[model samples]
Target: MTDDSAALWVNGSVARLQGMPDDERLLDTLRWRLGLKGTKEGCRTGDCGACTVLVDGKSTLSCLTLTREVEGGSVTTIDGASDDPELKRVSAAFTAAEALQCGYCTPGFVVALAGLLKERGRSAPVEELMDGLQGNLCRCTGYAAIARAVALAREDAP
Candidate 1:
């Protein structure tokens, strides 16, 4: 608990947050200090994908991520992805497909899908798409619609 270890900038914005004790959660800092609410804290223990966000372009659970570790890297949240046309399309497809129920975990799913779709491109196969989204769990509508939406968005792309 030193005065030097208070908070720092994340991505490009200044974040005034304090890391919890060794056992505490980082999700609190994200929600409170950074005002990045896109990463949800479904299961604080890291089982649920609800707290997922991007760390260096990889999807990770913000609940378990320490703010200190994030200072030197890029952390992209669902809110950050909204600017991407592909992500916007993914979001629209998810909405049109009705892939969400309570909407708690949709942010994680969308962020993960953004990474998957961007890296895999529109030519990816169904199996690859399924594998990419394997970690995102949706308790609402069947994942078929979600997957279909992603696939359709891919096909619709030039």
Candidate 2:
């Protein structure tokens, strides 16, 4: 009965998300079909980063990713980011600096920071860092503290 379903590979496990015709709503599947709840559901329109996850080693909006599109790709969540050194640094810095107030947008910022640190390296200027983090929005902190957290994280990056 389950043989005619597409398999989604996530967090080193393969699960078939049934009822999805074209993998279009995989994010909801991850929350509903699977038990991975770390990835939150925010703006379903992709405007918010609450549903952010790493697809193929890059930060992507889970709300926008189709389950079929990521058939063979590796999906990494906040739970998976703990092992990444750069992400660890960012997490620590965020905590130390109190970068998050409401914390709804923190995960997305961390994920974005990871991608930026990976692509731009550790020496990115503050301005560039600000630009890189523009996509992830935080309404509670006014962004100054978050920016400082990223700066400290970059310094702590090896």
Candidate 3:
């Protein structure tokens, strides 16, 4: 690490970025620099949840987050499901409920759900959990299975 470089904990590992720009977005860093393409870019603005990732165990819109702003924070992307227990549980529930179609929004939904469970606990009410995902929009599958997946994750999480 150099004086001009900063780092963040990504997927349970330290990711040191050299000569990073001040205005670089976390979404771009994760996708282009780190090659973690699982976090899709639905909208460059925060309106879409496709760029969601867990920063310090909280769901954040990476499109609106500056990479340098999250320096030293733990970032859990969907690609790191196996490295995070909550993410693993949520992902399993999503899979079992067959909540994905086209798959572009799956990562955001999973990460958002995992973050909600982490914030609200596994015992959080199903309605609250579902409501927390209001920012996440999916053009396919109609969210019935997604709702089921949320319940399953809440029930299955320990």
Candidate 4:
């Protein structure tokens, strides 16, 4: 490892990174380097949203994002969202709706829903809601519970 270094704000805290490989993905940095494992790596490609995280409060695929791209930017993982009131509501909604089976994809769904709510407001239409969540895939829990969780979160949103 050379003197390559990059710094970014992660989960509201500044992360000073050094000696990172050029090909390292954001997911790898978050999980291995930062020890934030809530962001899962489902597919290495961008097909699966399991590695979703909020970059500057917008939903982004960590697997597809390179570590260097996050330099000077802000990242919010599921662990970070746990401190947010809005996301707390979403998490409660997920629980009430029983939206998770193995819980592998739950963090991605929560991050996506939080991004959607922030972008479209709490009164987003059903069509928009469906579109916003289309990127995520859950094999065991199915989509019904997830949709219900979104609805519940919307209703609970202030």
- Clash count, one per candidate: 0, 1, 0, 0
**Candidates in descending TM-score order:** 3, 4, 2, 1
Cα miss at 87, model 3 (Å)?
0.3
Question: Each model's C-alpha lDDT?
Answer: 0.71, 0.76, 0.91, 0.87
Per-residue lDDT over 43-131 for candidate 3, one digit per residue giving the tens place of the 0 to 100 score: 78888699999999999999999998899899999999998899999999999999988888999999999999999998888889989
lDDT of 4: 0.87
Worst 10-residue stretch by lDDT in candidate 2? Answer: 1-10
TM-score of structure candidate 3? 0.95
Q: Which candidate do you rate higher for TM-score, 3 or 4?
A: 3
**After TM-score superposition, what is the CA distance of residue 45 in candidate 2 from its true location, in Å?**
1.0
Clashing pairs in 3: none
Question: How do the candidates rank by lDDT, highest first?
Answer: 3, 4, 2, 1
Q: CA lDDT of 55 in candidate 2?
A: 79
RMSD value for candidate 1? 2.8
Question: Which candidate gets the maximum lDDT versus the true structure?
Answer: 3
> Worst ten-residue run, lDDT, model 4?
1-10
Candidate 2 deviant stretches above 4 angstroms: 1-5, 16-20
